[model samples]
Target chain A: MPREITGFSNPLIKRVRSLRDKKHRRREGLFLAEGLRILAEAEEAGFLPEMLFYARESAEHPIVRRLVRATEAAGGDVIETIPDILHKLSGKENPQTVIGVYPERIVPLSALDRSSADIWIVAQSLRDPGNLGTILRTGDAVGAGGLILIDDCVDPFSVEAVRASMGALFTQTIATARWDEFVSWLRAGPGQLIGTSLNTDQDYQMPTYQRPCFLLVGNESQGLPTTYEKDCDILVKIPMLGKADSLNAAVATAVMAYELLNQRRAR
Target chain B: MPREITGFSNPLIKRVRSLRDKKHRRREGLFLAEGLRILAEAEEAGFLPEMLFYARESAEHPIVRRLVRATEAAGGDVIETIPDILHKLSGKENPQTVIGVYPERIVPLSALDRSSADIWIVAQSLRDPGNLGTILRTGDAVGAGGLILIDDCVDPFSVEAVRASMGALFTQTIATARWDEFVSWLRAGPGQLIGTSLNTDQDYQMPTYQRPCFLLVGNESQGLPTTYEKDCDILVKIPMLGKADSLNAAVATAVMAYELLNQRRAR
Candidate 1:
């Protein structure tokens, strides 16, 4: 049986709400994910919420019932709360019926097997949580092994990013490291570092991407620094036939990712 | 010389600030755009703002001087204001040094020249302004003729959409029409309607996209209704090789748009 919490000032509710903040999430080693579908995706990805909260009306839902069973089986706490508490936890006008608090799953850079997939995505100094999430989704779509974040990228565990990811965060391997650390890791492995640059004359589609190809994208505004570009094995540019000088960071990543996937498939 | 205004309560100041709201923008037939770079892009695209606002600090900027000259020459209002006014107008902590209120540009579906470009983007019931803006940027990057919005969608002239467009709003032609009206217009022209759908077995890259291809993407949430999907000339699905079932609406559009572009280029 799930615990019933009617009080607005419940301690558990307050604790769950604090997961919205990055500091609190990092300190607790847990992050919040909402919506029945997302929570279901997490379960499908072999994850069980440490704590699950659902509105009273959703207790009869088949997926909710299954989630409650699985969470209980995993010795996790399940709580039934009111719509007000759901709204408070999600910080949205229309909150999801269910919310989950899951452990942060950041894979170490050294642990990633480059041979697990033919393609990988690397983002340096990516600032937008939404873009990060979108990239994760695109990475998953293209069957990339994982996403490697270099330098100060936005927290992948943020509510905005988690929501924007549409559950791709649970699907893709995520690793964070300094630029030097990432460079050393790449040098130790058999992978081609393909950087998207404006300075390059080579078109994006011109190259035959090698197996274990690492597609490197730059920051939202500044793009990749010259030093980082110099480290790349291949530099390519997407043609901008219109007056706009560049595509959105996430959009550029998707275009490049699909190109890599197409090239490998054609081969 | 530009008119100088310091009072926060000045009528013109209040009026420009009100342009941030959709209701005011629609009523006045003007929309707000900010940043020197975006305004420069706008100028390069042959648009003169009806009213241009610049901080006194930016008076010496070469681009700002050129803009002032062009605005004055075109009989547009040019105002020299403080940072506070710019901040208020842009609704950003560190606002752009310049802001412009330009006339809204929404071309009718009948007015679009189908022969102008080999590819066009069509979106149905897209709700997010950021996604809408990103799609505009993608359309511009691929040299697509324009973006055709179907049914009720977010206001293209909203400040959020304009900012997210990153000045692509000035380069790409924007049109809005209801589903029936759009179908009529499309039938009257030479174009292929390719839709991204999960219901199809056809791969997105398998088909040779016909010239003047119209890549249609649906809503962020519900996707295209069954009726809309049935209306498409070619329905294809992007392979989701991972756990995530779909891509972000804008990401899907970009993926599909580039595929169309690539197919055309190969021919």
Candidate 2:
């Protein structure tokens, strides 16, 4: 049986509210969800929620109740709170119906198909939660082999990341692994590695997707570190036509991903 | 001649902070800025500032003092404030030591080069500020004719939007007009009007970009409303290979714009 906690002072509610802080999220190994869609996505993806709370109005909705029951059945803790409590936890308006706290799911590189990939994405050190989420969603949309997140990236499971992903947080299998180990394994492969840089003479289209390839994009402000650029088998760039020397990290990633997919499809 | 206002209750200060509220932004026909780069872009793009505030730290810097003097001499209200007061008005971390309130800039369609365009982007009611901003930036980079924001779109001039635009907010001449007026102009146009939709049989590649065209993308969640679909000369879609039926509004807009640009370049 699950116990109901009513007050804002309750430790669990306090924990959920504090999930906004990076320290709390790290300590609890849990993250926040603002509305029903994210909770529903987590549930559908078979992610086990640690806890889910419904605003009083949401408690009456059949979908909300059903999801709560499912969460409990799956060994998740469920709670109902006054709207104010929910608001306190969310610190945002119209949190829809339900909020959830879930354990982060980390995938292993063994989980990704290596041989079948015509293209793959390697994300290195992004800071924004929303940017990470959008990148995951884009990688999923383009049918890339899989995503590899290098260290110092935003915690992929953060609330802002999840909300920006719009349920893609559940659908994409992004895993965290040692950057050195992944690169070492990648060195052994017949696959080619492509990285973006300003000085590269290689246009992205040169010697591209006829074989499995990896596309590496770096952080927004400071780009691919010099250490990794030398390791790339192919360093190329999307030809720039405008004075703006940059594209948002996710936009650049998407453009390259789409081009790789299109080139492979044509072959 | 400039005056420094110290009171929190001052109407001007309150109005500036009210910019944090969306309704006030709409009612006042004004938006806020927090940094030097944005201020410079605004000036370069010919936006006249209504008021300016500078901090003591920034006032000592040559560029800051120059801007302060210029803004005052331009017949704009200038207030010199302590760093603490300037920070409050910007609502941003690491305040840029300067803030400006500027009226919205809108261009007339008569000013657009109708003959030079084979591609136009119609943003149909996108409500997210970042996504809308990215759309404008991408539209300009990919060489789309220009951006079209329909009813229900968020204030593209919002601080978050302007920042994400990466200075495209200044270079891109965006015209805000009635969607119906846009549609009637498209109907009389020398180009094909393409709207992005999920159910459309018209694949994005169906028409080559050998001719002038318009691509309309819908809002973040509920895509193009049905009435607007009727307005599209041709509705085309970026093929989604994944289960998620969509991409972020900005990403989708970029992909579509790039496709047009890519097609034209190929020809």
User: Candidate 2, which segments miss by more than 4 Å at Cα?
Assistant: A1-5, A59-66, A107-113, A177-181, B1-15, B22-28, B46-81, B108-111
Residue-wise lDDT of candidate 1 within B116-182, one digit each (tens)? 9998999899999999999998998889999999987898898889988999999999999999999
**Candidate lDDT values, in order:** 0.92, 0.76
Report chain A TM-scores, every model: 0.99, 0.89
DockQ of 1: 0.87
lDDT of 1 by residue, A1-267 (tens): 899997989999999999999999999999999998899998998999999999999899999999999999999999999999999999999999999999999988988999999999999999999999999989989999999999899999999999998888898999999989999998997999999999889999898889899999999999999999999999999888888778999999999999888888788
Per-residue lDDT for A118-213 in model 2, tens only? 667788998878788888788778776667888788888787888887777776777777778778777776677888888777766665564677
The two-chain DockQ for each candidate, comma-separated, is 0.87, 0.51
Q: Please report, as a residue range, the 10-residue window in candidate 1 chain A with the lowest summed lDDT.
A: A238-247
Writing each residue's lDDT as its tens digit, candidate 2 over B1-267 gives: 668887778898888888877789889888787677667766766665789888866677776777777788789998887776776886666676778888767676666676776667777777888887787778667766677776877888888898788767776767766787887666665878777887677777667754677778887889988887887667787776654678888888777778887777777
Which ranges of candidate 1 are over 4 A from the true structure? none
